[model samples]
Structure formats: structure tokens, C-alpha cells
Target: MQQLLVVGDIHGFPETFVELLDVGSFEQRVLQLADLSGRPGLRGDNLHDHLVKKDGLQHAVRALRETNGPPCFGIGFSSGGTALWSAVKEGLEIQALICVSSTRLRFETSPLNIPTIVFWGDLDPHRPTEIWNDAVPECCKTYAGKHHDFYRVDALAPNSPLRTDIGAFIESVSGLHSGGPAPAR
Candidate 1:
């Protein structure tokens, strides 16, 4: 079975994280990254820098290294997505990446070796579609909604279209078991 590490936005763990990851196939397991906020040592000043670099990516690495398991998959939203990519950029291994509403994606010269799927709302003010398109190519999925629209707390589950897209994307990469899936036409 595959394990998925869910990284939430900077606002902390979004309620949608659990429900959204629940839509995956049984072969995949879900682990939502802990919201270190509201905790004693992690509460104030430089929180972003602290978690993003020295302290942040470790969570994923620890999760993957626990029990000497295989490289776990990643699902990140907004800043969480940034953390996921940062882990990869810093040499942490991930089987695949599913990023939603990510504003900044550090592009390197080497063609990305991992399979990546990016989802940005058509109405998101963060970055234009062209940027995401250029970054992820055909692997980007644009929905008829906004940044926070992909997942909501009160709903019984995540949006249906998003669910289907996520499930399909996960399955699409099952073959690689390494990098991201090819762009879907």
C-alpha cells in the first residue's frame, strides 16, 4: 500500500484535509501532517522559515523513514505544497506529488524526475494558469472554482470533481511507482 502525506496551507490544518484524502483508493494510506501551530515551541515569530526549512520537511522525512518504508506520496495545498516540493528539492524522495493552489514552485534546470500533478482554481488570484501550465504542463488540472473551493470543512466530503481527479491522478501514477504520471489529455 502507498502512503500519502497531506500538507495543509499556512493557516494550519484545513478541515478538508482528512475528507479530501479519504477519496483515494484503498491501496493508498493517508497521513495529514500535524499542524504544529497552537503548540508551545512552534507558535510565533519566523514560523514560516522555521517550519519550511530546518524543521518543516523533517516531518515528511520522518514519516517516510519510519519503519524503513518506501518513499511516500505527497499531497500539499498552498504552503504545504511548498513544503512538499522543498522536501524533494532538498533530496527527500517522494513517489509522486499532488499540489493544489500552490503559489510558488521552484523550477530547476534538470527536468523534474518525479511525477507531479498541480490543481489550481480558475479563479485563484495567486498565479495565472500559464505559469502552472508551464510548470506542470498537461499534468495541471484547472477546476471551475477558487483556491479554497477544492476542500470545505462543513461538507460531508470533498468536491466530487476534485475527488475524481485526485483518484485518477493517483491511479495514473501507480505505474511509475516512482515519478509523476504523464500529462493527461
Candidate 2:
């Protein structure tokens, strides 16, 4: 069976957001970074400051490494995505990656070998630049909202367009619709 890992943003995974994804069939694992400790209210500069001071991303990468096992599909939000990307670079096995609003990836220049996709809101000021988008191995999609909008409680309506697109992408990457194995990008 396929394993699916979900990494939360700095604010951690909200219950509503968790319910938005379709992971019923896969063996799933969820990570809430040590820095946040399940906190969900931090925002703006406070969030950035706290993460930087706590070396949150590095901790997250460590946590991922400890849990590392067979190749799996990964979904990460914001800083969590950066941690996963870093973990992949450090040799944690992953078949594919889907990152949402992971603006920090703008600094990554090295190409990833596996299939990967990224999602960001068009209105998010911190969204990655054209150069990063162009360099990524797979698709980069933009939604019509600000940063964090896609995962917000109000935006997680069951059939929201963002959720639909994300679900479709997961299916395609995991080969859920096709009997064949996932593709190598």
C-alpha cells in the first residue's frame, strides 16, 4: 500500500484543513513540528520570528529523518514544505512531493529528481518568483487568494476548487486512477 505523509505549516495542521484532503485509502502520517506544538494562532512576523528562533525547519527535517522509511508521497504546507524538500535532499525516500505556499523554496536552485508540484495563491505577496517556478520539475499552480487562503477554515469547503485541484494532483501523482506505478519525472 502507498504511504502518504502530511506536514503542517508553522501554525500546525488545522482540523478543517486535514478533512479537506482525501487520504482514506493510503497509510497516512501527519507531522506537527516541535516548534509549534499544535499552536494554530500565530501569524505574520510573529510566526516568522518564532520559527527562525526555534530553528523550526531544521527540527522538522530531523523529525522527518527519524520517521523515514519506504518511499512515500508527501504533502507539505508553508515551512513544512521547505523541511520536506530539505529532507528529500538529505536522502529521505519520497516518491513525489506537493507543496502549498512554500515560498521559502524560492531559494532552492538544485533540481529535484522526483515528480513534484507546487501551489500558491496569486495574491500572496511572498509567493515564489517566476525563476523558482520555472526551475521546478513539475507544475506550479496559483489560486485566487492570499497566502494561507487555500487551507483556511472558510476556504476548505468540501468541493472548493482549490481542494478539487489538489485532490486531482494527488491522484495523478499517486497513480490512484491508473493501475500502473507512479511516474518518474
Give stretches of model 1 more than 4 Å off: 15-68, 106-111, 128-132, 136-138, 153-159, 176-185
Across 103-176, the per-residue lDDT of candidate 1 in tens digits comes to: 65534233246888777777776644465476553377666655543544312245466665666677777653
Best by TM-score: 2
| TM, every model | 0.66, 0.79
Q: Could you tally the backbone clashes for each prediction?
A: 3, 0
Which regions of candidate 2 fall more than 4 Å away from where they truly are?
Answer: 15-17, 35-47, 178-185
| Model 1: ten consecutive residues of lowest lDDT | 36-45
Q: How many Å off is the CA of 112 in candidate 2?
A: 1.4
lDDT of 1 at 48: 54
